[model samples]
Target: MRAAERELMARLPEGALMQRAAAGLAAACAELMGRVYGRRVVLLVGSGDNGGDALYAGARLARRGAGVTAVLLSPERTHPGGLAALRRAGGRALATRQKEDAAAVERAIRSADLVVDGIVGIGGKGGLRPDAAPLAELAEASRAAVVAVDLPSGVEADTGEVRGAAIRADLTVTFGTHKPGLLIDPAREYAGSVRLVDIGLSLPDEAEAEALQHADVAALLPVPGAESDKYRRGVVGIAAGSSRYPGAAVLAVAGALRGGAGAVRYVGPAGDAVIARFPETLVSDQGPKRAGRVQAWVVGPGAGDDAQSVAEVLAQDVPVLVDADGLRLADRDLVRARKAPTLMTPHAGEAAALLGVSRGSVEAARLHSVRELAERYGATVLLKGSTTLVASPGGGPVRVNATGTSWLATAGSGDVLSGLAGSLLAAGLSALDAGSVAAYLHGLAGRFAADGAPMGAHDVSESIRSAWRDVMS
Candidate 1:
């Protein structure tokens, strides 16, 4: 998989790398243009290699008979060779030095058939500098296809977190491998579609990658044999909801029902509430030990802050998903001692609590936080939020779920997700697969249920079968 460290190589001569990048970038631009002979192209050039890449690509476009123009934001520090090449290929190179110049450049952007953004790259610290900011804004307002070289300017390369403003690109021609920022959120929102360009960099070992495609997810989904019965599929015991918040228990059970588990054995205080909502669920109030054998457990969705219930769930040897209230009550070692796998699904607030930090810290550096949780707990961690991420103890690619909507912030949504994931584990998927696949489907279901309108937690749970249909179909 591709990453930031692999993309930022200093071993080779800077000029050689730029040339290779420019070649791939030009090819991508050509593919976008289809017929470059008469197209008008604008190159937004800055002061670094990103700017150089745009200039070089512009030169190639101009050589192929396209009308190319390079707007220099920083004339004094522009790439000399790149500027020379564009000029030699009959492309107009101009420098802007005024506030109104941004608008004028925007007009030029509007007139262009395509725009190449080389304003910033991995090294940029803040949002767009004064001049480049307006230019990027204007490009956003324009109709031309915007292709970012390396990554969208102002986006973090190592993490998908966006600190300040950033340009939204239609396509990003990245080098070597993928950057973590390209796969994560906020930054991922600005990156429309990512295309990898091989520069022959020997990358180091990666800790994680991103979401599994359809075929990959299909491979990971549990499939029952003809001889299989509900018992063979494994049972999931749930400790969720209460009299005051019985809806949480019902929704959690709603999620677990479709989780492919043979049966759901609910062992919480609200057994009557669970039976009332989901009569199919096997309900018990006699604690986990008497709830019959289960392959996995789901704890903490509305389980209240009662330390007793959290302690009972953690005491089980089955694979456990510690979420919501359980994240607060359960000791980390109890989870560590589990013989079966452990999965932790914590939204920003819960994750912050687990790490003893502010919620803002977890949001700002989600990639780091997820990895840290997995490493610290020795369990798979699914950090839920804008860009839900799944991190594993044994490093692979961190899967980033892209299908969630703001509407999913509705109450009880997480309870449904936790139960769904718990069921996947009971069905025999690894903790990572169970959690990631559940996140993916849950997000899709949330979107399907909402359909741009508001929805309740029950709506989301009911839509799971539809989302399942989407995957199965």
Candidate 2:
């Protein structure tokens, strides 16, 4: 589902999709309430199909002997059929006829047992209006477990932006496919844990995906065969690091060693330093072309704007990771015509340069920007930040690194990510697989290394083995 958004809505009727959504939502409520016998189910209803879905689901719960109530925000514009259905099923429907203030709504919301927020969905624009703002505040402050209908209300379904205020849900029962807002952050902050309900609405072919699951990540990893030796697995060449920045190369190689590889080959002025730190790495003083056969190349971590060296590495016939300076030196045609896979690991800034857009633009719409980069360069792209997203040009599951700790953002952290991913590429995993798995494993390692304390890049690299051990068990 990676096609354009407008095209996705073309296949289904809006009304039919709503009914299917309500049905799925009712089923989830039944499961959550266990037997649904005399349990209080409160729906903070709004003036949209999202609220309609909630009211209809409340009707179903009332039918099953549960006590359900819908607190409508817009009484005049409530879903007509939904009101009738709730009454028939022995559910009570109430409107905020008192004060139309945020404080009054917050009080009602705080008193709920299982609160259903039908405030906003994919069609919403901006933040919560004052009338509905207090309800969101109450949901956050209360002991009630909020189960949002469609998506957490007040979240931008297209972009992941949370404007003024948003409902923070313990569980969001989203209709149809996952919206981009639920997957991307800022808004992702409000959505506690996302759960999907398959209604019949056809998600657009261009629907962006996020966070690859562990089983998928495991499949992406390169496991060695019995006959494979160090030479046969694959050799990865690194042209990162300079006299000015020697530590970046060290961290990259440290990560590379953990990436399932036959061998790692290091070439550049940092040879002495890299060898001194990682004695296992095969260091060479020769040029990239003369550095011998390699299955993959990891370039640009600390390599400055040496145009000739960057071009030489790009000219090679292996999978390449263009990062830092490598992104600046890249020729569009050269990238497209490359003999093997290409993976670009750029933070928001680098992606902005490649797309000729502002850094804020990339950060604001990371999912879209990463996919655009992949399609533009015909490569896999990993956009690193709070939610590390890996998007492939081939339209696969986009992986988000949820395992990362805040401490993982230290200097040279990204350098470590590159080396680890490059090693996986050398070991024969596809670009998407290698990049996503690296992000996952790297985050896990970071958490292990840091525990609760702040850490340097070396500590994160050192934690790789322990994290791997835990995974094996």
Candidate number with greatest lDDT: 1
Query: Pairs clashing in candidate 2?
Result: 1-205, 1-207, 2-205, 2-206, 3-205, 3-206, 211-400
On TM-score, the leading prediction is: 1
Tell me the tens digit of each residue's lDDT in model 1 across 1-473. 33443455556665787788899999999998799999999998889888999999899989999999899988899999999999999998767785666566667888988989998878777677776777777788888999999899988887777777778899999988777788787688788888999977777775456666666666777778999898898888898887787888888999999878889999877888888888989998887778888889999888887677778777877789988888888888877777779899999998998999999889888998999999888899999987899998856678888778889999999999999999999998989899999998899899999999999989999998888778877
Every candidate's lDDT = 0.86, 0.81
Provide the TM-score for each candidate, comma-separated: 0.86, 0.82
- Model 2, range 1-473, lDDT digits (tens) per residue? 32332344466665565677788888877776677887777888888778888988889888988888788888898998887888899987667655554444555466666889997757777888887887777777887778888788888887677767888888888766777777787677777777787654455465356666667666566677999888788888888898898888898899889888888899888998998888999998787888888999999888887666778888888889888878888887888878789999999899999999999888867777888998898889999887888888867667666778889989999999999999988888888888888888889899999999999998888887777666654
